[model samples]
Target chain A: MKRFLVVGSRDLTEYVNGKYVPLVVEELRAKGHDVTLFLIENGVIAARDGSKAGKVLNGLSDKGARVYAEDVSCRARGVQTLASGISFSNLDFLADSIAEGFDNIVWY
Target chain B: MGKTEPPGSKKKKTQKVAIILSTGSYQREAPTTVLRLAEKLLERDIEVNVFAFEEAVTLTNRDQIEHNEPPSLRKVLGDRHVYVGKFVDQLLRVGLHGAKMDWVTCVLCAQERGVENHQIGGSIVGTLGDLWKFVRGADHVIAIPTYR
Candidate 1:
């Protein structure tokens, strides 16, 4: 199975790019690829407990795709509690993922 | 005695600056800042090249202006060098046109946006390779991301 990492930079419901990420991840996973969703910048909202995007991301996580929020981004935005299933990560992970040869890296 | 520099030893070099703008027209803030910067650079005799992409391409649509005013791109960019990526066909009412401005749109971006033969007169259809030529030849490149 191909490995995929999708990076987002805006709240999932705030822009077209944000809203499209989960859909793209689901599609890739449905096609039998392993997918990981990483939210950064304002996109950290996707991991907030009560946000609309957070719920959607939780559903995607339950379906098998892994979801994460950048730790620095969350701290800056005061996002203390992440939505269920979303984990905190860092840029180091992103660099390592690239080095580990992810088949596809999508940034939005 | 301290070291004495020779006369005419260090001639002033003309700075070549390039700006890539990705915000659309309506936002106003980012584009205004870009034009102001370009104007400031021109005042200091710096060579400026501007490339507009995504929604920023709307700046080339002359008819979309709400009203004419100072600091507006049309007023400020007069006789200046400007370019827009062709993917703009999706949002533009018309393409760049004017006697004083030099404007070109990326051909591939335009075709991808289904803008074949549809842009207003005066804008040249170019390619990304051409854009890269400017970027590579320039001394400094500035990118203004989309804000809205």
Candidate 2:
């Protein structure tokens, strides 16, 4: 049960529409590993309230997965705030990820 | 900073900064992280490269498959960047074609997507070795994984 970061950036539907994220996170957590998410740029956009990605993200959050975004990336892309799913983070989170020795998983 | 420097230098120090687009759907805007990071690295005169392989190669297709973000990855890769795409044509359908990755060594990904060694895109059938080299040579390898 190691900590892992599953980056969900592109396809909102898979997780948002299809519930892929909830299923995977549920299974991973069921297995006893801590799971988190870092949605950035367009990824962060998915987090917007009322967005499909947002709904999906909300579901994952309900299940105990901590979610975040790269603040710097968000700023560069003009994303002022992250939506329903999670909070925004500074690049320091990237360091936190490395410091904590979390495995990175990807979802586009 | 010979791989022993403190990690906090990320903001102050420059990095070689090469990223593997992998081209899979998982990358999304993050895949462009390669381009974003590359631009930053290039500002400091560091080198940046985009390597594509595996099902990741499927990324080049810009057809806007249902329920995706706007400005497909190909649109993002267009801004003065260098990337290698296996099944490069698949990416081209999305309007991505600058430097096809021919200079690097290619090996068969255990799953094998290309046809007779080639997939729909006339890509140089590739493998994990290609990925390993990118990881070994570059400062860091960020994978933008996609799921169907």
Candidate 3:
């Protein structure tokens, strides 16, 4: 399966553009591609437990897509707790991922 | 002894990242985020190429000044507010000692914003061709749009 690293920097509050990340992730998962959703900056808001965006992420997680929220971004926004299946990551991981090579890298 | 290849005959296979930044500073956090990411990438010795277009061209304006906060808001705003240009300059300086970084400001965009002649010392005034060159050479690409 082709590997994908999708980075989202916007939060759900910006509904118009924010929705595309989840939508695209869902489609990629449906096609059985390996996908990693990396939420950074304000995008970490989607990892907060009990939020609508969190629910969507949870659903995506259940579908087998790996979801991660940047640790610094989460702390900056005071998002201490995360939804189930979402893990905390750092820019090091991002850099390493890019170094390791991905079939596709998408940024939002 | 093995035959020596000509100097500079082969290009180094260094990992490179291209960041397309279309957003300006102060109004949003995207430029700050781009700077942070660029620093982190450089720490890993990844070459960074930043293609700044639209309002992002204003980020490299050398005329940026940090003024003291107004007396009324000084308590919360601190004595002086740091400008994004300072950070950009610092990053460029740091990159000089380690992994290289090219901060290219679109010529058309800079002219539109009247920052063509005011760009920081290290930043290059480039055409759209330079943007495509960065994209073509980079192993990874990150685009920070103007909207968000």
- Which number leads on DockQ? 3
Q: Report lDDT (CA) for all predictions.
A: 0.61, 0.51, 0.84
Give the DockQ (2 decimals) of all models.
Answer: 0.02, 0.10, 0.22
Candidate 1 CAPRI grade: incorrect
lDDT of 3 by residue, B12-60 (tens): 3339989999988676778988888888878888899999989999899
User: DockQ rank, highest first?
Assistant: 3, 2, 1
Q: Assess every candidate by TM-score.
A: 0.46, 0.49, 0.89
Question: Candidate 3 at A24: error in angstroms?
Answer: 1.1
- In terms of TM-score, the best-performing candidate is 3
Candidate 1 error regions (>4 Å): B1-127, B130-148
| Top candidate by lDDT | 3
Off by over 4 Å in 3: B1-14, B71-77
Docking class of 3: incorrect
Distance (Å) between predicted and true CA of B130, model 1? 8.9
For candidate 2, lDDT tens digit of each residue in B65-106?
344334566476553333323223333232233322231213
- For model 2 the local lDDT of residue A99 reads 34
For candidate 3, lDDT tens digit of each residue in A1-108? 687889888886676877778889999999988888989988999899888889899999999888888888989899999898788888777766766646678888
**Candidate 3 C-alpha error for residue B73, in Å:** 5.0
